[model samples]
Target: MKKILLLLNICIFILGKEIHAQTNFPYYQDIQEFKKKDSLKFPPKNGILFIGSSTFTKWKDVQAYFPGYSIINRGFGGSTLLDEIRYVPDIVYPYHPRQVIIYCGDNDFAFSDTVTSADVLNRFKILFELIRKEYPAIPVDYISIKYSPSREKLWNKMKSANRLISNYLKTQIHAEYIDIDPVMLDANKKINKSLYLDDMLHMKPEGYRLWEKVIKPYLIKD
Candidate 1:
């Protein structure tokens, strides 16, 4: 009876540790799924790699947008720039992409009120520097945070962060800041409600169509 009780306690402790780990690292499972897919057949190198939050992840038909170019979409859940920095090895480094386009920072602002535009910009800079450290020649592009009805309150902070990143990119070689926000606005310079889904957070097909048009010119062709 004593031995069984001791074994049970050990099992409980191990299980508890696993639960804690999952909570702490929210996208572990999502990344593992990507690994599983890659193990079957890894994508070709020197392709365009898109890494960020659900905006990219939810783009299930991203390949359709750009017909000729090879695209590896590594966007996970509603992840922040910090999460991209953490998982760079698993998502960014392995592929050796010719170009990396990012769409993050919005989630960082959404998730925490205290997180300022500068804070998010700093996080982005950390990520950019990390990538440059590994692949100095690789071209990196940033898609400006979109204006959405659901997160209207945080638009100002998002715009500020976008401007900072855009200016910073201008100072670096092989880096492009793809500003898609202005195109997303209507004739009156307001966020077009029709572009977003019912959630008013994630975009609809119209929004993605706009992205396809803007992002096409920036893609590098071998």
Candidate 2:
């Protein structure tokens, strides 16, 4: 029995390392450089962050929209939930941020036949558990998955995955679910025509405007 338990622990540890969490990616290094440049031009971090995948990374006008807030955009394009799980130490914890607003899993929903939307939620759930262990009292805010204009094919999966995360978040008292998806969508439940770029995957300036609206209210002064 003891021998079986030892083998189980070993397997768990091996699999833990096997998962493709974002490591020292060049993108993260580029972001580090951007932060240095932004510091030279703007102000230093005062404990606020918008952390996530491409959506957060692509938000170039963060400072313009968020005045008086020391916003750190720790966003890396093309990152999955697994990458988030791996890179939390680099992106999240080090800053000792007062609040973290996270937006991810859009790319996870992009793949058609691999993991189901429910499975993606499962990964996120595990991520939340791990994050809770790391930062017990800090509030974690989630931005609902946005509709990528050109990626209508990935929309259903995005909704499904977001629903699972949102529903779970509702049950937990520690987190806040920021509902930006609805306002971003048109009456037809499709992404607004003017909101996205030509690529169909990214938001244009107007889309970021709507994001700043709901997100601005939650900003706690440092």
Q: Which candidate is the best by lDDT?
A: 1
* Winner by TM-score: 1
Error of 2 at 43 (Å): 8.3
Q: How would you encode candidate 2's per-residue C-alpha lDDT over 1-222 as one tens digit per residue?
A: 544644453444345534423355435565566457656774354467777788888887788899888887878867877667656655665677777788888877674357577767776776676567767777778888887767778778888888888999998866888889777878898668778788878888898999999888877787
Structural RMSD, model 2: 5.2
TM-score of each: 0.89, 0.80
Residue 177, model 2: lDDT of: 80
Candidate 1 lDDT over residue span 1-222, tens digit each: 544644454454335435534565778888889999999999999999999999999998999999999999999999998778777777888999999999998999999999888787777877888799889998999999987899999989988998999999999999999999778889998889989899999988888999999999999997
lDDT value, residue 140 of candidate 1:
94
Q: What are the clash counts of all predictions, listed in order?
A: 0, 0
TM-score of 1: 0.89
